[model samples]
Target: MKTAYVKVPFQFKFEDVPVPKCGSNEALIKVMACGVCGSDMNAARVEAQDWQSFGHEITGVVMETGENVSNVKVGDSVLVESGSYCGTCAQCRNGRPDLCASGTGLFQWKICGFSEYMTLDKQCLIPFDPEKIGYAQGTVIEPMGVALDLFYTTDIKFQDDVAVVGLGPIGLMALRLAKAAGARNVYGVVRNRKNTARIKLAKEFGATDIIYTDETPLEAYPFPAGGVDKIMVTAPPSVIASTFRAANLGAVIAYIGIDYGDRGTISFDANYFHYKKLQLRASYAVPALYFPRCMELIADGVIDVDKLVTSTFPLEDLEKAMCTLRDDKEKEIKMVMVRPELL
Candidate 1:
């Protein structure tokens, strides 16, 4: 089996290794497709480390299951959860599995999904009806779960005016979900750029307005009822403060992002927040909830995964795919690489 790895400032390569073995409680998955995430590009640029495996957004087939595995069987098509909750955890017992403290996997397997075959704990596999979804669409379930988490976290109300700062795939999904949930005005915020691809899709997916930060600051955007009732930020931590300025009185702000060093810290107006009775919530889609719901949304024609998945590459084209995603963000929304033979 061949697996992808990256190290140093920007080095990436593939190495042949023995196919991973399924543990007593694990399942061996024949990876069919994996989506390249923005964080993967960021890791290649900023992280310095020894050669390590990366890609996580995954959809695969169950080739084998350990003796203890029963949730799924061989030949079952599945989407791997990047995270899973321990059923024994206190939070799970309290019916709040999303907050499970002992939940495992920021990414399920040590070997990663960027390989021909990998083994993971059976708990991370969510079996889906392959007849209803294709491999490429399956690759998006994880990210859709993320968007759903942000939607629920913000508690967006019907007829509420909303602004989604950062028009990445996740941001686009967020805005679309907000619109489907009945938000009156869906705003997709982006930095000034000429690539109208994202801006145009935002409208197609239900964004009522596109706010280019350089042209008109989010704080100055004219939304109904004084300002947007809800704000969802999927950008870096730095954008949180200015994005919050667009929120209406008593509005809720939900954000999911990560940054290292000084860039991780953000400063916003505490007095203004207090006076406005604003609620700020952090959304981390751990335990990777809502896969089934996301799949339903995709299958029922609500999400239109084909529109968001702008490009596909075979596994052999990993380098080209990564470069396209890193250097040409304007064109590609979500890139998925597949093993055609495996598929």
Candidate 2:
């Protein structure tokens, strides 16, 4: 079997290794298609002495399953969870599996989706009908689950004004979901006009307005009703304070992002937040709920996976794909790596 790994300064390498053995409660999945994430890009840039395994948004077919595994079987098409909760944990027993602390590591697999074959606990597999969804479309479910989590954190009402900071895949999807949820004016905020493709897609995906921070800061956007009813930030933490400036009074702001060092620390007006009665919420989708509903949304054409997945490459071409995604921000959206034969 062959798997992909990355090193600091954005380098990629491949190695051939023995196929992993499936445990009694595990299933072996033949890789089909895997979505490259912003986090994966972050991982590639992190300082590390050895190559680090990456790629989690995956969709594949079950080639083998252990005798004890009943949740999935051979020939089942599924979306693999990047991590899962321990069923016996207190939180899991109480029905809040997302809060379980003991199962935070990547399940039994050594390397994830960027491979020829991978095996994982049966509990992490969510079967989908292959006839209805293509391998590439199947990979979008996990990220949509992520976007859905951010949406759930906000109280967006019909005709409400909503703004999403950062136009990454998750951010773009969040804005689209806002439009489908009935937000009268959906705002897509970007740092500059260099992201022409994404800005155009934002409007196509139902953004009623676009805010470029380079020209006009978010806090001074002249939004109707003084500002938007709800705001979702998918950018780094550094941008959260500015995003808060664009929120309407009594509005709720939900965000999901990560940063290290100075960029992670954020500062905002305490008096402003208090006087405005605004709420700030953090959305971290783990044990990753909402796959079924999100899949339905994609299947029903409410969220078009095809439009978001702008490019696909063979696993061998991952370096080329990553370079395009990083340097060619204007033309790239979501990039996927696939095993042609499996697909």
What does candidate 1's lDDT look like per residue over 224-317, in tens digits?
6778899999999899888767878898989998888899999887999899899989999987899879988887788988888888888778
**Residue range 225-334, candidate 2, lDDT tens digits:** 88999999999998888877788889898889899888889988899999999999999987777877988898788888888887888999998888888888688788
lDDT of 1: 0.86
- Alpha-carbon RMSD, candidate 2: 1.6
**What is candidate 1's CA lDDT for residue 145?**
95
Question: Against the hidden reference, what TM-scores do the models get?
Answer: 0.96, 0.96
TM-score of candidate 2 relative to the true fold = 0.96
**Backbone collision tally, model 2:** 0
